[model samples]
Target chain A: MIMKQFRFEPLAQASYLIGCPRAKEAVIIDPIDDLGAETYVLEAADLGLTITGVFETHVHADYISCARELAEMNDVPHYLHESATDLVQYSFTPFKDGQVFEVGGVRIKTLHTPGHTPEHTSFLVTDTARTDEPWCVLTGDALFVGDVGRPDLLLGDQALDVMDEATRAETLYRSVKDRLFALPDHVEVYPCHYGGSTCGGVNMSGKAASTIAFEKRFNLAMRKDTPEAFAAFVKETAKPFPDDYARIKSYNLGLISKDAITEAAV
Target chain B: MKPTEVQDAVAKGAVVLDMRPPKPFAKEHVPGAVNFQFNRADLAERAEMSLPQDLTYIVHAEPDPIAKVAIGILSKAGFSVDGYLEGGLKQWKADGLPTEALPLLTVDELKDGLDRYHVVDTRESFEFRFGHVPGSTCLEWTEPWDQMEGLESEKPLALVCGDQVRSAYVASVMQRAKMDAALVFGGMVDWLERGYPVEKSPKKAKAPRI
Candidate 1:
């Protein structure tokens, strides 16, 4: 199995393609816009592989996701957390937490890691050819290289009350230490976002991957600070709410037709 | 000399010294005016380097009060400061001097025009990525100005970002360098809001990569 990560620098977002060369099967995670899908499909075709599944970690607010569009185009099943059905309008096979799915020899175990949003999930993928411990954990917006997703984006009816700086900070704290840190230290941590991402306040280095142990030691957002201090710190550093967030969210919920993708070389 | 005499000297190619911060100068000003930040301690050093003592000097500020103080400084520097721009830049702009737009570009514009123009993105890289005009080389505002010295001495340049202030500063810098440049009015937000085309980064480009 070969895994490649695509970093979308503008949005500070990352997507993944886990391919099993022997079986010619693959899966994509958290597709951001159409670029990820186009790149992954071209690369997979170049390597003689086929995409069987598309997984969306959650409805992202920062950028529009083309996961449903990509899945439909490729004739692949789209996977989402069962709880996400209410939040997302697209059709998908709802996988409950702890459910395991197989793509060739790779076994993926889904873990509910909701704080970034109520339906967020992380996938731990184990290669049968390798050890029982997963090779890498695909943590979407739920965890970043040096920070956790800010929970304030999903505050709908209680948008004002739940988004009080302190409440979101405490929620982020619980999501990281309680859910993500419990994984084995040796497991490679592949986060969905890096620095420059407005989704999380403190993304770390530009490098796409880090070890759970490495982040546990060097990630400032992971340090043992009091909840009060953490709240204050995040409040001070938090980005102003993105101007296009509501539009992006509505797009993610299938409330609007996907905009035509423009083709211009970067 | 009187203000009318100063205006007459300016018509004959005398220098109009705009002692305002870069921000106000970029918005609108006397067409050929030069700016020197009044608050900087190295004001003398910068003025000496950029300003030619041979030309008659006319001091100006956004409001008139600062112009009076600038005239005093120029006199102390041995400049035969003639007079000031009465009512300063505001008056000049109000009188219908040319004003430029500052805009962030769509990715498509960046791709099509990147080679033809000097592409300067003033926004931070993170902001650049959420979708920037393609082909734009990011020159972060915090980065040292000398790094951009390699750009040709003469080219039509465009400065882009999420807003006007930063790009306007960039345009002023290029203008000071005597380069042909303009601010992409309204910045990137304006471009997108108007439904202009923007290319996604190549790695993230799901659409056919042009």
Candidate 2:
């Protein structure tokens, strides 16, 4: 499998271009809207790959996603969790939990890891030629290097079926403990944001990647032994919500037109 | 042909024509198998240019159709062909046949054994201008496999890019061309994050010392 990470310094956001070079095909995950669709298209071409799909881990609140634009531009499917189909305005291919797809020698399995937001997903990638075990996981916003995504973003929001902060925090804990922590110790963890990003709780690492073992050993969120404890940690560390999140989320959900997203809004 | 039959045919001096992409072929394949990727447009031409027509060959490819396509192309190229392996390498492995793998080096392993490798930085010159492995040769990942320079050495080539993705692809193709190349998983990002020594000035790919 071929994978490249593109980092947006200002927002501390990261997007990935993962491909199977032999198959000459690739996919973009969590593309930033301001990055422009052509950036990925040209980048993939330079690597001798064609963009075949686009995926969003969740309806992001911090920034808009270019998943729709990239998918439409490439004439490929835009994938989101089945639970998000009704919540968003645009059309997409709704994938269920544990759904697996192949791009040549690379196999990507979707794990429904909802916590930060209800429809969040993570991609577990395997290079079948090398090993049946997953080589790395794209943890979207669920699990970061030293911190996990904050679950309080949707608290009191107008988005569909909003949950309270405590309940969402508990769900995130379970998702991390049961779904993410279950992976092998050596599996590399690549999250969407890192240090200086508003998405994760305080203590997020400046490092871009970490092994599951390292994260398990040092991550503050993972140290919490119980869901209640984890919820309390989240509440204790919650920072003031960014004022532009609602506008960003609305644009991402396609609730508003592209024109509605002014330069000042982002 | 069934997996067991492929083994029998192999014993009778039939060559296994692996029709998968270079990466899978590099990672694992039948012992003594020759890879001619099914996706290559010049599969028949490349095979005809290199392979002996008198020898019988068996196709090993996945999804069944890929194997069939290779077989058809070989037959048209006037090569004597045996039937394809029933379930490709997956079935071959299931039947307990032996396979081989190329090296996939982690950043730490590459650092520890730097002397044993001809470190090839596959990142672009612009990216390489910032920082790269000390004494590494800069050969952009997009450089055609045959056109790549500074790789002919007693030491195995260790391929690196900003991340492992580009180097992995280059290493796959390099292995397919029968070069002694190992992919540096996580590449320069991992190397830099680990605080390894780096050369800020870019170096051009030069012919290897005799």
Model 2 misplaced regions, further than 4 Å: A158-161, A263-266, B1-210
DockQ of each: 0.01, 0.03
Candidate 2 residue lDDT tens string, A148-173: 99988873555564667777788888
Candidate 1 residues lying further than 4 Å off, grouped into runs, are A34-36, A155-168, A226-228, A259-266, B1-210
Model 2 TM-score, 2 decimals: 0.57
Top DockQ model: 2
Best by lDDT: 2
Docking class of 1: incorrect
Chain A of candidate 1 compared with the true chain A, TM-score: 0.89
Instruction: Give the range of the ten consecutive residues with the poorest summed lDDT in model 1 chain A.
Output: A257-266
TM-scores for candidates 1 onward, in order: 0.52, 0.57
